[model samples]
Target: MSRGARFTERLDLLWLGATVGVGLLGLRLIHMQVVRNQHYSELAERQRTQVIAQAAPRGRVYDRNGDIVATNQPAFSLIFLPGKAQDPARLAGLADSLARELHRDRGELFERLLEAAREETAIHLAENLPLKTMFKLSELKTLYPGVDLIVEARRHYPYGAFAGHLLGYMGKIDRRQWQRLKGKGYRVDSWVGRSGVESRYEDVLRGVDGEIRMEVDAQGRLRRRLDEVPWQVGGNVLLTIDSRIQRAVEEGLRASPSGTGAAVALDPRTGEVLALASTPDFDPNLLLLPEWDSEKQAVASLPEFNRAVQGTYAPGSTFKIIMDAALLQESVVRLDERVFCPGFFQVGNRAFKCWEKKGHKWVDFLASLAHSCDTYYYSMGLRMKGPTIERYEKLFGLGRKTGLDLPGERSGNVFGPEARKARKRGWYDGDTANLSIGQGELLATPIQMALVAATVANKGTLWKPRFVKRLERPGRPPEDILSEPVGRVDLRPEVWDKVQEAMVGVVKGGTGQRVNIPGLVVGGKTGTSQNNLGDDHAWFIAWAARPGEVPSLALAVLIQHGGHGSSAAGPVARKAIEAAFDLASAKGHEAPAEGAM
Candidate 1:
């Protein structure tokens, strides 16, 4: 119990305390390395490894005859890996060099490089780089530690701006879309179809991405594709469109003074859209480029509006076709019964003037439709009022969606009793008169007009118009194919014959004479719808051959701000019809049965 004995005891206690501390530290290390190993490993993996998305090539789109309209081409992209870089200055220098080579501002490149050097992990330096530029960048890879060249697939339209609206375009994924599609495998760099068929068939056209697990060193260089899973290419789309006829329609539309217009041609038998053209089309390639001024100008120059499916115009005299059909169906107006036209007719407090201010003294239904006698139909529309006309309009696919596969399809404005009431406008006799001639409150898209034409051409049956013929998926079984059926609407035979004959006469002796193609029986109706909002919309709806033709083609043309249907739209329709006939002749297919005009 002396001082020496006390010192030795203290040393023993200190040694024991030290041993206990070391044992505790060893147990803690085991717990962290073993029990919590996965958590830390995951955190390390998250920090060191980044999953960069590789975009799958979108499917190619083809025409009816297997002509390629839309396809994918190889693109080079510049990517930056922040984790691979050591010095920020080196990264900045590399970015500056790239900026100089690509003709970009050095400050912008420096800012981007600084951002990329952060913990963001993956950053895109540039996208859709040309192959030559990408190869040059690859050669200079040693100068840029983190920068790398990536081969990507980009959407390409073979026909440039042709059928652009129908084909649509793709754009980079935005914040909203990214948030919505993040877990669903969509990445920020992913391109999505923003409009038209591209938007509508996005799911079908977006191919599945493949993945490869590669072993990399601390420097992050790939060793091999470990257990690689191949990606699936997008499906192929076969359109019902005839490129030849589509080109002709586009050329004719472009030739007109009104640069904005749309033309849709369909097969009466199958409701296949032969040609769908929209004027003022912007090239999809331009949208993908860096030239903003060129892009704006290109879009501005063309109407960029799809007039055929989206352009809504007053039917004008063309509504006579519907009225005539409804009258014949209801037996309200006899086909041979004569109605006197004194240039204008008085309905309620309004006196609606006919197209021919100098009236035809007396005219029957056939002559009325041929001459587009407004007074005759104005009287008839009064008899067939409200629900009666609405029924016919619905049957003709007006005021409703055509269910076309393309996106942004409008149901069009068809004012019913409720709609009229909502608008606070009472349905007056004058309204009926105007409606009879397709003027008052009646608006129809060019596609709707084409449908009406098809109904008349097919006698009584109305077929649902379709643009997409078939979808071909890669590596998938054919049994999984999706095919839309040909829809038909039934009508009385007599009603069909009388309407058909009148439509035929419209082309032969009436306003559509300009559209008559040689060696082909063309039945058509011309419409100059009044647009007080702007210049009148010119329209022409027609179909080739009689009811019996198996592949009967129907068409409708709309000219924006064009003065008259005959002058603006008729010539476009004529060119398209001529092209179709020429195609038939070239293929040795029998020309549509010739019917005298």
Candidate 2:
């Protein structure tokens, strides 16, 4: 009887304990499902959800006439989600598969995948893919869980190689740049401007990027998008370049015998750059190709070189214009004064020969400039010496930067008394004679020479070169860029008149006669810069205008190794003038014949 009672009590205690445990478990379930539901739900959601950034379209580039130069095009890119490939085996397999399709090294791809996995972020595997490769990648997506395809905006240039140096190109951001720009909303895969106007205006062109918050399944496949912030497109840049004039300038350069040089055209009244062209230009679109590395050395040779602001050469006899002005201003030489030139001038027993072997027997100020008599200037240079010539050169803005908006503008060399003194070198009359005639250590950019013509045309005003006409932005007013005056040349009215008349005489029948256009009064100076490495560099600086009105156009043309200024550089300048005034296509309008400088 005692044993049966003990067993019944034990059973009763076990039943009571089981009932208490069941009640406690029910309370715990209620707590998790109600009181702290939001907190625990968020924890689980964070494990399966991710935020992916979408690239923003860069700003567009336009010429002065509203022609689009640079814009955006839709491109297919391979996106890798690192969270799905965190496992070592899965990551290695995915990297190997992507490397084959992308033509990338497997070890490099594996390392990149491993780094992204450690950062718990997504990355771009391959971009700007061809449609055929994109389709192959899409098929690979079925086999690879973390792989995806997305459309992105790729930078495109419409004119191909035209104005390529000025328009610039783009490239993917390296790790160093990403570290600096990531706070500014730039992604690791973001493309940035590498040169030209594109690099100069990167801040204005690079708009803010946006992202999409999405939910993913256990396998890392996107299930549904929770929310998204739309990306903002960048501002629009309008250049001061006239596409027609730019085309003419480029055509002239390409047509030259060297096929390697630079040209610049400017509005004489304002410093607006009508056309800025450099030869051996590149098609920026080609750089976006996957095989670009193979052609990199060839591309760097000539195509990427921006010769307009970057190339500096001796001004040659064109510097005679400065000598003419300096001599007249100092009263060292009169407009009617005559000098004898028998082909050569004797300076310290050294003979400097003129371009014309049998030179002008005797020439006055105007005739000296008109005929580009090297002997006449050589004789006068000895009297002027170093100080006076240096003064005029500095006043004319030689050997200095033009402050053009483009990047990498070089300040050409100006070696005179000061420079020679610093280097403990001697200054001689021979040196002065050479400098006086735009030779020997006197170098200038095409832009500087163009400004010289503009200064003469404007009768003494110097305008800062302007490239951008305006900036157009969405949801904002258009910003117009205006011309800014940097300096002015002060001379007597008669001084300007004499200089202008002599220059006019140049086109009327002198070395630069080839630039002559009908019904347009043209003034120019011919130059044959001596290049030790090759043949002389031909140059012509000129300005054109209608009768009884201010000049409108100014130009500077250079032909590397193109022997004579009048014969080589003159024709190119003539072509530019013809295009500017629409005379090349005009009926019965014939350009003047090339003459000797």
Candidate 3:
């Protein structure tokens, strides 16, 4: 009973243990084959598939009359999928081959390849690939698994360096930008706007990238194309820039004696920026190249600097118009008021000299503006003081950003009581005298001075400056951008008329005589700004209109280190006016004279 019973019990226990083991194995099988089927399948699928991102083409930029400003050109890039070729040795060998073929540094290429592997991302070996190299790589693609040639778009500026500052240029997305923009469809190799309208409208100009999925073999060789998501192109931007006027403005800037300056042209009635030009501008197309070295060249003058809205300088006599407005509005000076000038005006212990050494012996208010009498303005500055001067300067949009639709605009300084206190300096009557004549601590951008002329042309209305006129988007209605009046100088009609008369007198027989045309009613002011750095800067601000018509074009031209406004800047204004009005008799326009303010 003892031995037989014990054997039977042991056999039953063994059977129970075997039954439990079988049930556990069956559950494990069910979990593996059914419960996690989709998950395992995806893991297996990923091992043999590769996704290639297709970059969307950037938007096109057009001028006012539909001329191309910036556009995209077809290009090719070499992409390497590090995930497909996970072996470090394989990646090193691929990098060596790419470096040799693409003429790149071997160490840099290997480092980039390793980084891509560590991040489990694709790396662009060569961008804007040459046609011959692209074809060679295409033929060798099957040999280097996970490597493919992809089509890309490069920005192209049709006008080269013309209006380069306004159009801006493209640059590779840096680490900081990639960190911020990766979630917004930006890849590590994405190109972004660096400045100007490109930067200001980056969101609208950037297109969403699409991806192409491909099935591959275990060796990372492509087997077949699976599917692709088409990319949506970016919207087109139409600027208010008139190509003809822009050309004229650029030519005018180049014509200056120093060949380094800025010019701004505006449509006074609509506040449209017809043309904005800066000399010594670099080609935006050059910046699109793979190895741009402008930053490394140590060039004396920065070609990328946008002087039209960024560079600030004393407005010189061009500021007298603002003073005239203030003077008339406050009854500080009448149209017939007279000021005696003997070449210099005494302010405290300092004697401020006029541009005209001999001076206009006795000049009336209108003649004071036309002749740019510094002594007359000095007398007026004593009465106006710093606060009154600042008020009018701000009213004319000086010492502030003009709100131009461009990046890197500098709000020029207007040093008065507040600014002097901030700088721990005393405000003096000499400072007021200097400021009253557009000198001293006052600073103004070319765009702001252009607005001053625009204000006068549009009859005291300060219209908001506009660059973009329309946006044409895919599957959307064309959007028109309208600029509303931002401010107005509420001066009596007679006051504006008297100011206009003085401006006309300037062009007719005084400082700005060179800007006068045969049949055009042109009003302008000349300025020779004192610069401590070098020679005085020449300036001319003007407004042009046909007889009995509203002023259409208002412009300001500033020539750095140029000797005289009439000689260096006035001719540029005339050329711009000729282009604006299509004046055929411009060849017969008067030659600029030296020594005029």
lDDT of 2 at 443: 87
| Candidate order, lDDT descending | 3, 2, 1
lDDT of 3: 0.84
The window of 10 residues in a row where model 1 has the poorest summed lDDT is: 588-597
lDDT of 1 at 84: 46
Model 1: per-residue lDDT, tens digit, 1-597? 999999999999999999999999999999999989999897676445555567788888889899999898888888776554457677668767787667777888787777755664556777777666677778656665456777778889978988888888888888999899878778766789888778888877888875544443344444344555667788887888899998998898889868788888988767788888887777887777642334534554555467777778787777778888889889898877999999888886778887777786799989888777888887887777866887777777888878776766677778545568888867766666667777767788888888888777766566667788787777765322233434445668878888878988887777777765556777778888788888888878888863356337788888888867777887788888778776432222222312111
- C-alpha RMSD in Å of predicted model 1 compared with the true structure: 4.7
Tell me the spans in candidate 3 whose CA falls farther than 4 Å from its real position.
Answer: 1-22, 81-87, 111-123, 135-139, 292-303, 418-425, 592-596
Give the alpha carbon lDDT tens digit for every residue of 301-346 in model 3: 4657778888998898998998898888888887778899999998
For each candidate in the order shown, give its overall lDDT on alpha carbons: 0.75, 0.84, 0.84
| Model 3 alpha-carbon miss at residue 432, Å | 2.1
Q: Rank the candidates by TM-score, best first.
A: 3, 2, 1
- Measured with C-alpha atoms, the lDDT of residue 420 in candidate 1 is 85
In model 3, state the lDDT of residue 460: 90
Best by TM-score: 3
Worst 10 residues of 3 by lDDT: 292-301
lDDT of 2 by residue, 397-493 (tens): 8878999998888888886888788889999888988887898988899999999999989989888898899987777899999899989889788
